[model samples]
Target: MATGLLALLDDIAGIAKVAAASLDDAAGQAARAGGKAVGVVIDDTAVTPRYVTGFSPSREVPIVWKIALGSLRNKLHFLLPGALLLSLFAPWAITPLLMLGGAYLCFEGAEKVAEAIRPHHTEVQASAAPARDPQALEDEKVRSAVKTDFILSAEIMALTLATVAESPFATQVFVLAVVGIGITLFVYGIVALIVKADDAGLALAREPRPASTLLGLRAAPAGAPTGGDRALGPVTQAFGRALVRGMPVLLRGLGILGTAAMIWVGGGIIVHGLESYGLGAIGHTIEHAAEAAGAWLPVLSGAASWLVTAALSGVLGLALGAALIPLAHYVVTPVLRSLKA
Candidate 1:
């Protein structure tokens, strides 16, 4: 009886060790999967802040939090399970679905670029609609943001799924869960900080002494001022001023980067999907060009190859998106409008 009990204990220990190793492997794979979806992640982060743009200062963080929660719900509740089911049953559909999502991204990115180059009369007219109450506006914004987040989250989750397609089903589930939670946290955390940064700067500019104290100054008596207090105020205010000036530019740059990233990622996905379908002419041409560039720049071969590929992808994405814009405006939009009617 003693020997049998010892053997049972040994088996339990072995199982525990295996479980621990499997968890570690899942974590490593999750990190890699998340890395592969970084482009979509950046686009997600960049696209989010605009939703909170017109809101009051007090509402900004709350709005961001609400949207973040929606994003969490999108990834954890919807996309994760849907992706798992698709992976299990309709594995072949994954690439085509991903390409569809990629096309949407390209369309969105190109629309933004077009708007930047020439203001859209339709958008201007739409903006002229009667304003709603603040609460209603806020609700509308949150809903819009959430809807947008759902699409981006789907793309991110799909990209993650593709990266881990070779893993066992159980492992894939574990890895995807890790990625979804981690990415939601990371993206929304940065967004929260970004939307509130101007307010934070304003607070610092208005009340530099307290800001200085937080920075490292020892607290002074309730009525008495410290010597360091006087010295830090100007410095803090100046820093705050810089931050205020810099934030708009930073946000604008992020918007541009996000748009470009969408196009680049979307184009790459479509091109790869074509290659998989044996329609590899465009991809082959790009690859040959990249190889030639790599040969020419021996020292920076890898970087040159990547740059060439990225440039071509961006061009293709832009072209495709431009083509789709007219189709969407004429056919898709009209159909959607009619359906709604």
Candidate 2:
């Protein structure tokens, strides 16, 4: 009986070890998958802040939290199951679906570029429109943001699913869940910080406690005037002022980066998908150009090659998106309108 019990315990230990290793492997895969979908993550983060615009300061974090929950629901409840179903039953469809999502990213990025070049009249009109009821407007904004988030979330999940397409079923599930949850938390957390940064800076500048207190410096001489009056207080206020001034610049930079990342990532996906479909001419040309560029600078060859490839891919994506814009404005819009009619 003792020997049998020892064997059972040994088996249990082996199983436990396997489970631990599997979890570690899943975590590693999750990181890589999240990295692959980072462009969408950036765009999502960049896009969400606008939804909270015009709302009172107090509502920003709560609005973001609600949208984050909606995003989470979209990913875990809808996209994850669909992705797993496709992976299990129609793996071949993944590439096409990814390409479609890539095209969408390209479209969105290009539209932004176009709007920057020439402002849309409707958008201007909307900006000037009269305000609605605060409660109703907030609800509308949240719903609209969540709806937009669904598209972006779907793309993120699809990219992640494609990344883990070859993993075991269990590992795929683990990776998808981790990437979904981790990315939702990360994007929304950064967004929350961004939207409230000015508030934080304002509070810091107005703080009654000595700035030294924040840094663990010597305690203020028994109730000394704080904020800009105390030693290092001016410095703290200056820093806070700088933060207030920098937030707008930071947001604009993020917008630019998000647009560029979308085009770059989308174009890369389309090019790779074409290559996989035996339509490798464009990809091959780009690859050769990149290789030539790489050969010119041996020390920085890898970086040069990657930059060349990305630039070429962006050019391709821009052309494709520009071509689609007219089609979207004309045929697609009219068709949908008529269908609704």
Candidate 3:
């Protein structure tokens, strides 16, 4: 009995050690994968805040929550299995799929560039037109945001998986799981903080203590409510004021930057992918030119490389996106409209 019991204890100890090692490996792999996806993650963050636009203060958090839930579903239900299957059965397809996603990234980025250089004329719904219910509009935005999140999330997951392609299968699964959950939580949590900052400021401002209230008013002004006015304190009030005034501008900047990133990342991906497939002459030529240009200051070769790459990518993205506009306008939209009709 003593011998059997000792053997059992030994086996349990071994299992525990294995589990600990696995945990460490998972954490390391996850960190590495997440680092590789910094670009997609940034683009995701930049795109999400716009979804909360035009909603009442009370509704913003909930809408974000809904979209977050959808994002979770996208990762767990669809992306997780798809990634595993692709890794197993069709590893060869992975690069092409990534390139396809990269192309999409380029197209989107290019489209945004066009929109910026030439703002569209949105004909406002006629006053006589039936007004869209505020709730309905909010719901639509949430849905659209989730759909967008799905694409971005897929790209993120695929990129992460690609980064870890050489790892053990279990490690890949563990890394992806941690990255998906961690990113989702981090993103929504930050968004929640952003959306609620004004309200929190107001609550602090409206506190009953006179000095506290005065300080709050001064500190947070527009954000916090004020004394006797139901507005928060002066500090909070100012903060709230600043937040209200600044949020639109901030969102617009993010939009522009995100669009630029899409184009930048997209074009870069395509160029790199083409290089991978042995079609790198254009990229090589660009690099050579950049190198020669930087010869005047050999120390700045690295910065020159980055500038040349970015400029080449942006110019290509702009041109491709511009050319596609007429095609999209004449072909894609009509096909879609016809399909819907």
Candidate 4:
């Protein structure tokens, strides 16, 4: 009886160890897959904050929370299962679907670039439309944001799936769940923080006591103090003011970065897809150029090569996207309208 009990315990211990190793493998795969989808993640983060804009301070966080829940539902309930099914049955279709998504990304990125250069009449009119009821507007914004998030989430999931395509089925599922939940939390957490940063900055600027007091230092006498008795209130206020001032600039920068990432990543995907389809000539030429550029700067060769590849990819993306704009506006839109009619 004693010997049998010990064997049972040993088997349990071995099973536990296996489970632990499996968990670790899933984590590692999740991280690698998440890294591959970083471009979509960035664009998601950048695009989200705008949905909360124009809302009263009280409503901003709630709106973000609602949209976040919708985004989560999109990934876990819809995209995750669909991706698994595709991987299981239609594995060969993955490359073509990914290429289509890449093309969409390029179109979106290029459209944004075009808008920045010259806003269309309809776009201008839409922006100038009179405000509706606050609740209505808020609902509309959340729906719009969630709809946009679905497309971006699909891209993220597709990228992640592509990364783990060769992994075990269990590992693929685990990694997908981890990446989906992890990215949703991370992206929305940043969005929540960004949209409220100005409010935080304002509160900080309005601090009644010197920050030094919080640091366990005595508050200096009224008016600026000299020497070791320096007060930190003004410095704190300045930093707060700077934070408030910088938020707009930061948002603009994020938008620009997101747009560029969309184009570059989309272009890179198409180039790779073409190579996979045996049309490697374009990809090879770009790689050779990158390699030569890297050779010129051996110390920074990796970064140089990556930058060169990305630049050429962006050029290809912009060209393709530009060519597709007219087709989309003139052909696709009219066909869709006619179908609906």
Candidate with maximal TM-score: 2
Candidate 1's TM-score reads 0.88
User: What lDDT would each prediction earn against the true structure?
Assistant: 0.88, 0.89, 0.76, 0.90
Clashing pairs in 2: none
Per-residue alpha-carbon lDDT of model 3 for 156-230, expressed as tens digits?
888778778788888888888889988888878877776776666555445443344455543534554455445
Model 4 stretches astray by more than 4 angstroms: 1-18, 121-131, 212-230
lDDT of 2 by residue, 1-341 (tens): 99999999999999999999989988988998898787898898888999999889999999999999999999999999999999999999999999999998888889989999999674367777897899898899989999998999999989998888999999999999999999999999999999999987887777655566766775555555754455566677777888888889999999998898888888988998999999999999999999999999889999999899989998988877777789888999999999999
Candidate 2 scores a C-alpha RMSD against the true structure in Å of: 2.8
Query: Which ranges of candidate 1 are over 4 A from the true structure?
Result: 1-18, 121-131, 208-211, 221-228
Clashing pairs in 4: none
TM-score of 4: 0.89
lDDT of 2 at 73: 95
What's model 2's overall lDDT? 0.89
| Ranking according to TM-score, highest score first | 2, 4, 1, 3
Model 1 error, position 200 (Å): 1.0
Number of colliding residue pairs in model 1: 0
In order of appearance, the predictions have TM-scores of 0.88, 0.90, 0.76, 0.89
Task: Give lDDT tens digits, candidate 4, residues 96-162.
Answer: 9899989998999899999999986653676778968989989999999999999999999998888
